[model samples]
Target: MSDDRPLDPVQLDAYFALIEVSSLLRHTVEQQLKESGGLSYVQFQLLATLGDAPSGRRRMTDLADGVVYSRSGLTYQVGLLEQAGLVTRAPSQEDERSVVVTITDAGRAVLATVFPGHIAVLRELLLDPLSDDDVEALASVLDRVRAHMRSIPPRSAAPRRRAPTR
Candidate 1:
């Protein structure tokens, strides 16, 4: 049988603090991205990731997994980017069912324009407060947590089953 108990105070505090900090960070970054380049944070992330790819392209599913956005949400954002001429999407050369997204010259230009301000805001809001050791530990801890979370199905998708009998 599993333990169905509630979290202890320490766990509760940590959980709340993590939630609050994530909310604040996301809000601030979104505002910064919007003001700087008129792009949502997710859009900027998608563009940046594509820009860094060797061919300025990646499979749609790869992009979806690289960011926090859902696959459907990424499709919508990619549509907006395509309309703006910032990116192009086509059937993957290797797999017809997969899509490949490529950052265009315009996309690279936007990233170039936004990079400075983005770095400044990130340093100010997220990095400046952390010492070197703190930053390393923070990355390590969050990376582990993210991997663990990704291993589980989201709550909405989790299977529902009847309780077991002895």
Candidate 2:
């Protein structure tokens, strides 16, 4: 059952702080990615994920899960990347029903171009201010929270419902 009570003051402060920090960090990262590589944050994430994969490729559903994005949204972003010649999609060899997305050499180049700025922004805005202990504590907290959240079924893992016929 859900708790009917409100968050304590400290919890309220932490929640607001997390939200604001997340927004600020994303905004800065988005600007850097767009300026450096002509990519949106999600596009950069897609490329980076594919680039990091052992085979430089991933199934579309896996991509959606890895990036915490909706499948439809991932498809549109992949389409844009395909049009830009940064990525390609093909039917998975292992599963004909699944589409696989792969990063092109050009996509790797874009990642290389943007990664430095991305790291710099992350360092300046997120990490530089934190002491080593603070960083470690934050990491531990986030890891536990992430694991807890992931215990729930992700959107990609859920079966899609069919529309009703008229």
- lDDT tens readout by residue for model 1, 85-134: 99999998899999999999999999988888888877987899999999
Q: How accurate is candidate 2 locally (lDDT)?
A: 0.95
Top candidate (TM-score): 2
lDDT: which candidate is best? 2
Candidate 2 pairs with clashing backbones: none
Alpha carbon deviation, residue 105, candidate 1 (Å): 1.0
Residue pairs with backbone atoms closer than 3 Å in model 1 (clashes): none
Error of 1 at 155 (Å): 7.1
- Give the C-alpha miss distance for residue 126 in model 1, angstroms: 1.5
User: What do the candidate models score in CA lDDT, each in turn?
Assistant: 0.89, 0.95
